[model samples]
Target chain A: MALALDGVSVEVTGATLVRELSLTVESGEVLGLVGPNGSGKSTALRCVYRALRPTTGAVLLDGTDLTALSLRDSARSVAAVAQDNHTELDFTVAEVVALGRFPHHQGGGALSEHDRLLCQEAMRRTDITHLADRGVLSLSGGERQRVLIARALAQQPRVLVLDEPTNHLDVRHQLELLSFVRHCGLTALVALHDLNLAAATCDRLAVLCGGTLVAIGPPADVLTPELVQRVFGVRPTVVTHPHTGVPQLLYTLTGENNP
Target chain B: MTLTKTTADHPPARPTRTGLALPVLALSLTLVVSVVAGVALGPTVVPLPDTLRYLGAALTGGTIGADEVSSYSVIWQVRAPRVLLAAVVGAGLSAIGVAVQAMVRNALADPFILGVSSGASVGASAVVSFGLFAGLGVYALSAAAFLGALAASALVYLVARNRTGVAPLRLVLVGVALAHGFQALMSVIVFFAPFGEAARSVLFWLLGSLGSATWGALPIAGAAVVVAVVVLVRSSWSLDVLAMGDETAASLGVDAEALRRTLFLLTAVVTGALVAVSGAVGFVGLVIPHLVRILAGAGHRGVLTIAPLAGAIFLVWVDLAARSLFAPRELPLGVITALIGVPVFVTLLRRRAYLFGGR
Candidate 1:
């Protein structure tokens, strides 16, 4: 259940999207990948899900090189909730979620009773059971995102990779989703732009800047003002949350007086 | 609002297999009725009972009265082959349409979208205008057309493919460009032909007809269609995954490139075989799959199963109308299909809240 990216680099058309990015998420741990725009958080996550192969290094599942395993085997262990995952055809929510069980039955076999139960369970957990018969095209963005998350949950993968999964979620759903991930007992690597939520949710934060890992540690140790100012080009007032004692950032506009 | 509902209180119901039974049974019965009507109601005015008797005699190898010989020949030898060919080609085109649409991830895509039919047109025109491949005797046109289709498919695959693999957009663009090029080539061949009759025949072939359907030709087209349908039905899940996009397909352990490659080859060959027998029959391939998807869901298994039956029924009637609507002067099958298909397609677009994948 341990997921490791060992010195992974991705170069596309003469541009290096990610460079020597090494990180590891221990079993059942929630690791947050945070960075400014274009810092390669999405690209790094793509490598873990095998959407894009690393140009140099490898992604390992418990010390086994991912590329060495068959794609079905690798997919059986790692499921992804990728950004921009859109479909033109109108599939009902249940049918879309059932696609998560694809690796378990690769030969276009009919879904077993167990597989159907898993799909139903996934939809229930994501609060999308009511939308099971509705077309995905008809859902609101947040609902669609939850449907996708439900699909990943239906995959029953040991390690989950999510890229910007909270893009369209409301505040309550965002908190609920994060809390679910934290307590779900699955090793997860999440890419997030919301630093506060990342701090509140993740056990460890890995910050990337310019396609390289700039910092990696617990939220309190990694979210220092110097690191935030240097990497994100922001002036931050770091404060401890009164309830959870996690580091939270209150940013001020540049060239403005602080109250 | 329903977020707090517990799984224990409301257990999800399993999907019932019988959901598709009624529609499938309805379509199958409709197809059978259409075939009978296709043979009975042609220009010769054969009575329904007589037509049924002829069909029964032919099927069971029973003896017919001597006085009914000519009518029996008209029903069994002429009308039957053409009607069956219409059904087979219709099924094949519909099956390939589903594959092609999923292959390119475009709702507008059809079996001929990859230029295979245009390529077949070029070869068929050459055979008609210049008697090319005459050594193959009766099979010259089909052989030439199949070769041309294969050649065009190879050209498209090679040009569109790169180290990263074939992207759907690139495949479509390359296919459309090559299709136009092949059309131009066919026109050139038609222009240079010495006889006007050759030009007329090529024109008829281009618009499509089941006029030449024979027992000899039926098995080939039927076999090709059967193989293609089986293969496509088996790959139904893969097709659904592939239609979502290559990246999604890859993440789910389906290799998009390999699947596309196999589909391109399969569709090309089957399309070539179909066009070789029936000419470039239009509309059936483009419209039937969407029609099926609207009635059924977008799942490939359901779409594939129903599309073929619907298409067979549609074409059986269309072909009958082509030969009978104008009486002695038979019309091209494509002309009738377009006349019917365009209006229906436009109405579907206008009336339904359907999005071809999305808005």
Candidate 2:
């Protein structure tokens, strides 16, 4: 599904967290949101997922206003892997994945055969089918992250929103997870702290600096050395990956190198 | 991190239908046994055979012969209503415990955590001492207590909520503070009661009792619990999602704030009705849900269904012990609950820290 943010702005207690941001992810594309620690990537994502209402402008899913739809209907269209998707209670992996079918069963019926199959398929796709009966809290960080991703997949959403999904992953798991996201064929909006991974994984990149959108385009154009140095305040050397030919950045500490 | 993927052949999935049915059946059977034992083994020690005959006749709307007059009155008029009230109050408390815990997103919340009990105490004390709402005649005390409980919960909601919503921590802190405030107020009213008999009655009500259990009041509490349990069971999935967290629940298409608010009011009414009649029988609400969650998974459907049955069986035995342990002198139900509940709760906590969804 196509997702558009039209001048969406979020103000919490007289402070603007996201300012007049307008961006669009076309159907079946991976759009990466990259920024410094507090540059409002998460804030913008929150507005899309309806965790917070935009102070101004709107979020549209396929030309319909998101706020106008019931949360259940909107959830059917969009699924999210949020930053704080940690479970205190220990639900089995299957049970966690089955919760994704919740929006479909709002009228209160047992899970149908189709729903159960969908959950099994989601677990298999995320490669956690073996852990189906295991308690979520017993899993390693990477395993837990994959379980959450499986849950999002079980929703069978048209649009996906992920906030820092790679935070808990090792380097190998990180690549596998992003590869799955890339091949899943869903329109996705993902926030990434690792610029090299973002450049490698995203079809397009939107860079934010201090609540404003600074650059947005194909990854090669968006990750230019000048823009990186200016926005990130660090000297960056960009190199093309040997296999994929995507632009990858190697950063140097400016003060240490100069001294 | 050492991550070894499991490649062992997975066992066939357990049938969900049988899982829920077995526990429910066991608990239901236990409840039946408790009721029979409770009625038969009281101070009078009626034989089991005669007790069953009397129960069978009473249930079928038949009368016994003149020789069974004493047994008839003892079973039908006295023990039956009291035992049924215990069952109703037990089921209500346990179910409401699940609702309140999920509503506030905290494991510590119970039916009375939001000051409902203390508020009920204030109202009951006023009625006992100053003849407040005496015009309502038979319902005056219960009516005042229910109103006070509801009012206190409403006040807690109004006070604890911020611009966004009631954050769980704030709700806990606000509820505890207001509960203390209400308790102090109850104490002040009891201290200056105009008569010694009024003070004694107020004290008795504060400690809790089922002595007021009557055929007239049983149906009201029973009807309230039935309605509340039906509503809770229907929304069980929503409760499961809500317990995860607000944002996750919203992402799953549940309006978390709206659901929480609805549960708050529903629990208030059910708990208000319970406290009005039973005077805040304490540990049943606090301990029973946790025990159920330990035995069953944290799924609301399973926990909510089984907790009521478990609670009913538990309270029947507790009430039995209260009435018969020191024959002719009855113990307050609250005293017996804490006396039993504390030890069991501590043992469970120390008995290997298995997660709620254990293998």
Candidate 3:
């Protein structure tokens, strides 16, 4: 595992937010974290991203404890694309992407030629190269998400963690973003609210319930109808995509098994 | 989600390099001219030629001849100190303004918004009304004000900071509450003062004045502004990250909590030093940084550099007008700042779509 959460837990004011959660994302794999709302997926991910420290155990990267590294050093290898990053300040798309180079350059000089080239490449990969000069505030929801993703990519991290990156994105953009993430060649840990998307895209899925990890395996093995009913309280008819043979969940609103 | 609200049916206008550079250069030049104008055109109206000669002589450490003595006295002993004080105070307030806005991550925050000014006013009023530090004598008011400013800022920080960090919104709320509390304390002190003359002086002092400019006070304020501006500019990149919110900043390798605490203390110290000498010069700290952002970009590097120069130029002229426009009965500097600043800020808001580096 390139990234491993070793029995990590988070307790805030005596309330267990995440309880002895453990998971691993091997090198060059997309691991999907799925659970119902308030299942502590975000809390567990926060430990990996350094937004919050685990109460008991450690988050290890490449067998080394992440807490042992400086934030700048850790950030150079682990980048995140979070759900709630809104700025009223009008930074240009290129400038926003350039901020990713901050960890690489500690002495605070102007961006090097290589840094500019990296930002340009990241923007191009995220398909926002044309919006380079436009203010990020002027971009649409989908465009802004791409800009943020570009910033994360510019970080050039070995491991990328995204929390609900597709929440505000439309259907086609969502599919395209996930597919892009899959082929981006970086070990990824993605938290998704949509079960079908997690099934279609992720190599494996980790299901969290109330704070503890209940199951972790390939989607076809772990996202069974019984497990879906037990964890999410929704019965999902698992189907195989005719084209890709990936497990695709068909959810029913009206059925004899309703709630 | 295409709630695209365009300011105009035009292209997004990024701040051009030439656009920022030209104005920064012009402002730099204007600041130089304003400093000379501030010294030359004061109440006594020292002749421009003699003012030039005195400045040159002072720079070269050469004593003036007998005939240029009166001009030398006016230029060196009186107007120079006043003008320099105005420039330093202006620069300090403006620099602190930029930092505080970034520190709190609010566009409206200023040096005084943290209750530092009101806290200092209370201390100055205490010295004036009750002679709280009678032993310090001439240095009493400034010392008391500095201590008070530091104390109030510490209180605000303690109240606002949380386990996660000092959230920007919490900081602003706590700062405003403290400011109001300190203002009431100041008013209570002024109301019950035994001497009517002392009360009036405290009122003038609260309104802010550079009338007490002295050779003794100049070095302290000068050193403070220079050091603060240098430190802030050096940390401009960290400040830019901080504005992106605490978690985002932390993920990007900046320690948001530690950085913000350091900035809060730095701003308090700088603001305390300035408020000690100049009482609370308003508008410069609040508006100058925004004005700089509008002309330049919202990046801290440009804003921090331009704010001090713009602020220095602005207050020099304002002070020049304050002293000379009304002759011997000088208007309080804060009154003039608000008078000019409000109309100018309103004009900027109405006229510019690119205010705060947004279009």
Candidate 4:
């Protein structure tokens, strides 16, 4: 699926949160969106997910207008793992995962065996199968993140949108999730704060500053020292990892004006 | 030998569905036990044998003679209606709680938290104290209450909403303001009440009671609650995802506005019917959902299904305690709920953070 935001901009209370920003993601490709807090990365994702309507322009899935699609139809196409996803009600792991199939099941029939099987598979892919019966409220931060990912996977959506999905996750789950998402071969757009993770996981990178897309390209080309210093205000040494061949950033915070 | 649970958790790879039969069996057991036990209780203290005989005759195609008639009349005409009314109110209150909580995403929100109960109370009091609906007879007060509840909720919703529309925060704020406003109106009315005791009667209507549970009221309340329960259970899946919050629900294709509106109306109807009959039954909606969430997890499929059963049982026991606590004198049912709800809520809050999704 091709996900595109065309001249999308949003304003709330007369303050523009997202400027006229446009970006595109090809099917089965991983696009990483990197920006500082409140730089409108989440807002941009919200447009695609329909949490907020763009003040101007539009979001489209394939060639169809997102605003024109019914909420249920859009949901069948997109799955999101957002920042700070907390449950006010405590749901068991299996029950939470089962909610992912909400768009597919019509009422008045038993949940087919296929539905259960898909839920199980998503959980397994996210490595949350063992926590099936455990209550979500009792789980640790990292484990809960995995369960949420499992939920999005259960939706079995063609386009996956993640907003800092690894916020509270351990390093291991972080790598595992990003890597798994890569191999799953879906159209994925992820907002990540960590530059190395962005470089390691995404096929293409889009950098945002003050609600505008400043750079777009491969991770190695887009995450250069000059770009990092300008966007992130940090001077870093860049090197290639011998095994994975992904670019790594080594930052020196000793500068007087360090970021 | 037993195996240890995994320390590093994974998402559940297998979904173990809760079968309808198990929950249904549990509900059946609760229904039978509660009904039988509730019927056996009351201030009149009819002998067990007499109670059984009355029940037996009522169930089977049999009749009782004049010698045992008073006991039969009290049991059938009086005590039976009250017990059944309590059941209906309990089921209805809890079901409404499930709906409101899901719609608003606030555990503190119950059906009456939106000012509908206060509105109904004002309506009933105007009829009773001012003799507005006097000619309408016994059903008049209840009819006024039902309409008042609906009108108040509609008014509050409209008053709070804007071009951007109804957010949970806006709804709660509006409800609180309107509830206090209604209370103030009641207070003003009570100040200049023509008769002294008339005020007391009207105030009692506000404190919440099922004392007026009549045989006629039972069927109406039953039908209303049954309708609400069926609609809720049918949409249980959507309600479950909704509690997970908006971003997730939207990603999964839930039209948040539509679901919220439908649930808001359903809860209002259920709340209107319930308060019209029983006054403002509080805490059942607030407390039962939290209790069910702890036991059944956060799924509305489970929460809505189990809440009504647990609430019915809880209210029956509480009502029993209310009657028996003072023995010869009957205690207000609202007094018992506050006495119980406050202590239990305090205990839960002491160990835990916030209840009702901790928002």
TM-score of the first chain alone, every candidate: 0.97, 0.97, 0.97, 0.94
Better of 2 and 4 by lDDT: 2
> What does candidate 2's lDDT look like per residue over B56-139, in tens digits?
898897778998898888987888888888999999999999898888767678889888998898899889878899999978
Which lDDT tens digits does candidate 1 get at residues A1-259? 4999999999999999999999899999999999999999999998898888999999999999999987788889998888877788877788889999999995989999999999999999889998887777777777888888888888899998889888888998788888888888899999999999999999999999999999999999999999998999887999999999999999888788965
Looking at model 4, residue B13 earns an lDDT score of: 30
Off by over 4 Å in 1: B1-18
Instruction: Give the top-scoring candidate (DockQ).
Output: 3
Residue pairs with backbone atoms closer than 3 Å in model 1 (clashes): A88-B357, A89-B357
The order by descending lDDT is 1, 3, 2, 4
Order of the predicted models by TM-score, top scorer first: 3, 1, 2, 4
Cα lDDT over the full model 2 = 0.86
Sliding window of 10 residues with minimal summed lDDT for model 2 chain B: B8-17
Give the RMSD in angstroms, all C-alphas superposed, for model 1: 4.5
The candidate scoring highest on lDDT is 1
Mind giving the per-residue lDDT tens digits that candidate 3 earns over B1-359?
89877656534657444434777788888888999988899778877888998998988998789988888988888888999899999999999999998888788899988889989988998999889999997899999999999999999999998887788889999999999999899889988888887778887887788888888999999999999999999898888877777677767888888888888889999999999998988888998988887666677777888899989988998999888888989898989999999999888867665534244
Candidate 1 C-alpha error for residue A44, in Å: 1.7
Candidate 3 matches the true fold with a TM-score of 0.95
For candidate 2, write residues A1-259 as lDDT tens digits.
4999999999999989999999999999999999899999999998887778899999999999999998899889889888876555656678889889998876567889999999999999999988887766677778888998888888989999999999978999999999999999999999999999999899999999999999999989999989997888876888989999999998766566642
> Candidate 1, DockQ to 2 decimals?
0.41
Worst 10 residues of 4 chain A by lDDT: A103-112
Docking class of 4: acceptable
